[model samples]
Target: MVTALRGVSERAEAWLDVERERIGLWLPVALGAGIAAWFALPAMIQWIGLLFLLAAGALVGVLAGWQRRLGRIAAVGSAVMAAGLLLIWARASWVAAPVLAQPAVTAFSAEVEAVEPQPAREQVRLIVRPLRRPDLPPRVRLTLRGDGDGIAPGAFVGLRARLMPPPTASLPGGYDFAQRAWFDRIGAVGTVLGDVVRSPGARRGSQPLRARLSAHIHAQVAGSPGGIAAALVTGDRGAISPEDDEAMRRAGLAHLLSISGLHVTAVIGFAMLVAMRLFALSRRLALAGYVLPIAAAAGALAGAGYTWLAGAEVPTLRSLIAALLVLVAFLMGREALTLRLVAAGALIVLLWRPESLAGPSFQLSFAAVTAIVALHESPMMRRFLARRDEALPLRWGRALAGLLITGLVVELALAPIALFHFHKAGLYGALANVVAIPLTTFVIMPMEAAGLLFDSVGLGTPFWWVADHALRLLIALAHAVADTPGAVATMPSFPRWGFALTVGGGLWILIWRTRWRWAGAVPLAIGIAALLAQPRPDLLITGDGRNIAAAVPGGGYALLRNRAGDFVRDTMSEAAGIDAPLGALADLDHVECNADFCRWRQGAEEGVTRAGQGIARGEQDAAARVILASRGRDRIEGAEMAAACAAADVVISDRWLPRECAGRWLTIDRDSLAQSGGLAIYFGERPRVVAALRAGDEHPWRQPDQLSGNDEAVPTDALAP
Candidate 1:
């Protein structure tokens, strides 16, 4: 043990010496670690308090370094880590908007701040300042029942709403809507009770520029193609139908729809080329000064403008930073793409919004770019590119080869991240990118930009018509690819620790400059093995406890719900790596579900027998394993309730808890669901409870005080005294 410790200490010392000249390379990584620490922490820290702690830590670190003769770089690294902590804490505190304190609100008046397009209806963002109760959250996101035609941004409108707090994850390890809502500063979400009445003084201007552009696009053209155009132009995907969106995602063409690195680079490149040519044509400019700077400036403006038009989302923002760095390189007469610039951009972005570190967009985008740049800088790639003296056709062939290589590298780099977050990857992503990328960069984007310009002069229809045609072709290709056999592959939920391991390995590979970097593959392989070994949950219960899904024998899940439960069933199926639809899986041969109950017959299926019988509902003692009840409670009398309780080993309520279930056997009700977020039951020798929301999840966003207690008994008649 002592020998090992000494060896580790020596290695660490050598590593520090090596990193001294490249300490800046580790800043973004340290910042990312700090952001991760914030997420793992049990409590949220105030910005002021975090700043004080940071100051104290910096002072201590510096004093210790001076007293102990520690290297200045090492000491500064400690201070930088402290700074990172302060950045994330400050950003979180700054964005911690008020949340509604009420458990349920039947009615409230709000001033409509913005109107957004949705596939089903018009979603409205309202600023609600209650005259009687000023303590409640001021901003709320309300989804109306229909298309609010007259409603626009900045419209002061009054509407009755039935509001509830933003929902948490519906099932264990599922989507965390509450976390997203917290960052978005949306306190409550609900539907309008009726038509929104706009005040006579209703106006506009508070709406985001991107939202307004999206509205205009929809007004100009209506349909899926128009939705595609709007999404490509303004990053507003609200109008796209679920079918189209899913098809695009499965085909791996979804990135083209969003303004990303490809779009920004292509647009800037085209603009610079145009500016250069125009300047070259002018004799006065040719005689005056260097035209490269002027053309590069124009390209920068174009990139920034596109970023604003696309709402400056994470991907677009990262690409814009890259474009600016390229311009800076041009001005300095140096190569544009470099590792140092990538690090600088990453540091700037992390400092700007530390919360972005947790998002898939940021992770996947940065990973792909970093890998692509590293590949371009490799010795072998440089040797390959040196063959520019070859024939024109050979050079063209090389370019095509490079494009294919680029696609493969990016897809490979993003594979683990996609699996960790989405659990699905497109098998034909590289081929799809080869065809789709050039089409988007050269044709679709330019056409749309031209259309936007021409529309201002009343000559936009032709350009838009051409753009729509291209979109149709792209959609067709996506549908074709997505429909292909095994076009997309799904995997079981990858463990978070495995993801962490993979990320660490990737960073080591990218950040190191030594042959020892190959050692990263060790952790990468181990992480994949761990991910493959992770077990899928046997059963999932929705947060309301109204819907339940049990894994089927081969794959997929059989759901038992009073209503359609599409979201829960599909989510569970995906996590289980089930490729089929929920409805198709609902009628698995071994499963029998009726209006009152669902039962898995023993010995009817191979895997189900070992997995245990999943029983839900029915009055007889035959369904003793599990009983789920939601409806007919208003119909059941006192005696019926007692009999129902006596018949089952466990009883679950979708709406409210019954007093009879307080300590008898085990019960999951709305109260427990609210407190726990969601439930995953693993039927090993005996059933075990696995909560979605851990003890550490009780942050300000959750507003734990508003959630019901786990052991609390709720009366069947909630309004009863």
Candidate 2:
């Protein structure tokens, strides 16, 4: 029994050791990345302070390293880094307060630096270089009408027009454009003015060698291969139709289009292979190794435009770094890849730009690498690989299986994050990836390379055919998968706890060699369950002429009111969990009133007599149990209505009250409200509240005919009390 216990104890100790090492390695990387993101902070002071902290920490670490206690020194260093990162984050949030506090502006002037057309929506994401201001940054995004002028990618123009924050409804669980822009150093946002004035500074100067190369490749495939070449080589999809984009997404080939890890790996692998073959005649391993690195550098330069266009996102960077490391290792005659390469790459990126740790690309990229490494080292995968030394057919079969397995594993690993951040899962992602990966690698990439080569020779016809064929194939694949039923599964957004649980579980599954991997399922299940258990709101009110919404519940009815089309559309769509028609509420029960008294009645429900002026006297006793008014309502009338519905709930309009109102009033402006009373919520802001009302909550107030003498409307004075 003692011997058996000792064996178990040893295993546990080993596991703990691995966990600690993983944390030590990853934590520093996360901290570093987080720090780098400080540049995106709106305030300068915070950035300066963070810079100071980081500098101080590094100095301390170096000083401490002079002593023999290396581990202690490292710990201190990590703590300093973490503290600096936290301070930076805090400062950024402090600066962001004012931005969020201010109401969104509609009209503004901005300089357009780049325009990416989204043909499906007839829109374009205008990357604007904002004019310097005392308070804000110098960049922003303006998603405006896409009138295809065959606008070049880097054209600069002055734009002036309305700009509003993104509607909450349009993107449920996807990227927050506002937050993303903020992180990308974007300031104020707005659309084009009348017509974009082509700025004198708009023209790009004489292009660099890489830029010229990209332009040449683009020109060759522009008319023929179009979207496919754009995606494969340049990572530019502004020219791609929405249909094609959606199809690619559905087919799981979306990664290929993005010029992510797969593309980088392919470039490196191809370069290495070509180098090896060319140097085979020389019979010199060193020469072959050197050639591969040079080839990789060339490939990297060739794909520079794509990398930059994709924002040189963390995952792409990781792949590039890994590839470079592999070449270096080969040049040194190292037979095996090391985790240190990945660690070093991560450390370098983190040191340069720490804020990347919070990004999905960073997480996904690192997760994929970690998964690959862990799996490759696992007994199961090694055993299988060792036995599979077959010819082309067998190799192909193994490769296919590996692809499928990797896709499934990565998808599963990223499931929680996707559900939390995107609020949806691509059900057909694995299947889509299977088709898209090879097509992109074997077909699209080669065509792009050939096109570039042909363009260099001033013969564009062959390249055009390749581009055309690739685009057609890509578009068809994306459309077929995207259109399939249940291709996307929508879920409620999960909280941080759920995300933590899910991520932890996923890591366990990937890393744990023992049966403890099954334990990971617990957190994953919890995350999914939490998302599924989210409650629906009772009432939803769209902001009047603004991109805001509110959910209200009182009496027997839930009221959803909004004047803005975008707000209304978003609220209804989110609340209903469907693509609600734009004008669906036009004929539904609605209350129309100016700044004064608003009347509420169901458009569909009959016998609801429309009361006029006398109704203001509170004689009939049947106005909504709550009288919701907008801002700037005449005080005398508002007081009267409040008094009339004193026994009932009087929810003042958010607009009517000061920017900061007392918590009791069923606040109705842009903010959200929770439903409590026995009210079948008709509102659509908070889903959970609506779900509660659906579970049967009778309204507090009933008509005089239905009520007894003991129950009469409460006085308005009682509302405040």
Each candidate structure's TM-score, on Cα atoms with residue i matched to residue i, is 0.85, 0.68
Best by lDDT: 1
What is the lDDT, from 0 to 100, of the residue 35 in candidate 2? Answer: 59
Clashes of 2: 49
lDDT by residue (165-266, candidate 2, tens digit) is 322223233343444444454544555545545445446323234333444555565542465575566555665665566566545555666666688877
- Per-residue error for 327 in candidate 1, Å, reads 0.8
Which residue ranges in model 2 land beyond 4 Å of their true spot?
Answer: 1-25, 28-137, 140-159, 163-175, 198-225, 279-311, 333-343, 387-395, 512-521, 538-583, 586-665, 670-721
lDDT of each: 0.70, 0.52
RMSD in order of candidates: 6.5, 13.3
Where does candidate 1 stray beyond 4 Å? 1-22, 43-74, 102-105, 119-135, 201-212, 215-222, 583-604, 607-651, 655-666, 685-688, 704-721
**Which digits, one per residue and each the tens of the lDDT, describe model 1 over residues 380-452?**
8878777667789999888888878878888888888877777787778788888888788778878888888
